[model samples]
Target: MKALYQYIKVIIQAFSSLLNGLLLTLKYFLTPGKSIITEQYPENRTTSIRIPERFAGELVLPHNENNEHKCTACTLCQLSCPNGSIEIFSKTIETEDGKKKKILDRWVYHLDMCTFCGQCVDACPSDAIQMKNNFELSAFDRNTLTRQLNRPDSRLEESNKQQKNTLAS
Candidate 1:
């Protein structure tokens, strides 16, 4: 008799659970076009689609209007990359006062190998690199994904030098 009672209790519980699900479905069916969680991706691409600011999409080196960047060729970003996605090539040059200075020659970023962890951006002391919100990273050729972050003939910004000097003094 206890076994039969237990079986009946389980049936009642199952029926209650089923009724709850059905009620939820009926509520959703009645309230059409309200509180929609589905986002039509491709159709809304150019319109109402919103991407969060914290989304780690693409790594980029921002250049000023004068085509100058903030990278000091410190290699901190390269070292912070876990997958070796960032490769920086720097060269030593002599200043006007004959002081040997290290400058950035190239800043290569391999988008294919990157995990979008944003550690490289965080490690940069000069704030040279940052993650942009552009997520369309698909490419037909793999070589295209291997990008140079710095623009051609770009140099370090003069404002960066002034800020460093002020901070030092």
Candidate 2:
């Protein structure tokens, strides 16, 4: 009789759980549009979605019309990066006064390995690097993921040039 009671109790609990699940399903089914959580991506890409200002997506170096940047090749951003995504290559150039100064040759950023922790941006003392709002970073080739942040013809700002000149003197 005890075994029969336990069996009956188990059957009742199973039926209770099933009824609870069915009630939840019915509640969602009867709701107007509240239960619909699927987002129509790509189709609604242009109109529906809005990217927030605080969203950190890709790293970019801003340059002015003069093709000047603030990066001094201090390597602080590269050092602070946990994933070693930033690689800076610098070249020493002899000034008119015969003073050798380090200049940024290439600022390689590996987007594939970047974790988007914003450490590089935070560590940049010159405020040369920053995260952009563009999140569409899909690529076909892995080599395409690696990009040079600095433009080929970009140079140091006039302020930095003056500072270097003063130091050299």
Candidate 3:
């Protein structure tokens, strides 16, 4: 009972000291036009917040000259994904040259399940795939997050044309 009385007294004294300090701080804070250390939540946005070109966020395949995705349907990326986020359905495609080549039949990716570890990017033999810096991935539906990226028939030729025009200019 005596120890309890002492503890209560100590606690009361500490609380009194804390209150005095807090009141002093609050006095300054209440002053008109006092500088605020924190900004309002999420009201500010600017172009400077963009990630650098080297900052990796998600992986995707580049396209070839024929407007086709460069993914050889190797399945290396699919196998390397830690969370099974990548699913590739591939089949043989015969070009005009009569050469059989692996092409993606279906490219299903669950971004919600992905950890973005970049293991799949490291495992790719072809310079076909790389991590892109698009991070605005919040979604309403989980099913819609199962995205289809780098369709087999991509507009690679248009990209090349744009590149050529940029180079020429």
Which parts of model 3 have CA positions greater than 4 angstroms off?
A: 1-42, 48-50, 64-66, 93-100, 155-169
Whole-model lDDT, candidate 1? 0.92
Question: Whole-model lDDT, candidate 3?
Answer: 0.73
82 Cα displacement, candidate 1 (Å): 0.6
Q: Which pairs clash (backbone N, Cα, C closer than 3 Å) in model 3?
A: none
lDDT of each: 0.92, 0.90, 0.73
Q: Is candidate 2 or candidate 3 better by TM-score?
A: 2
Candidate 1 all-Cα RMSD: 4.4
Q: Which ten contiguous residues of candidate 3 have the minimum total lDDT?
A: 155-164
TM-score of 3: 0.59
For model 1, how does the per-residue alpha-carbon lDDT over 3-81 read when each residue is reduced to its tens digit?
Answer: 9999999999999999999999999999988987677888888786889999999999999899999998889899989
Misplaced by over 4 Å in model 2 are: 1-26, 34-36, 162-169
TM-score pick, better of 1 and 2: 1
| lDDT order of candidates, top first | 1, 2, 3
Predicted structure with the largest TM-score when compared to the true one: 1
Q: Relative to the unseen true structure, what is the C-alpha lDDT of residue 14 in candidate 3, on a scale of 0 to 100?
A: 100
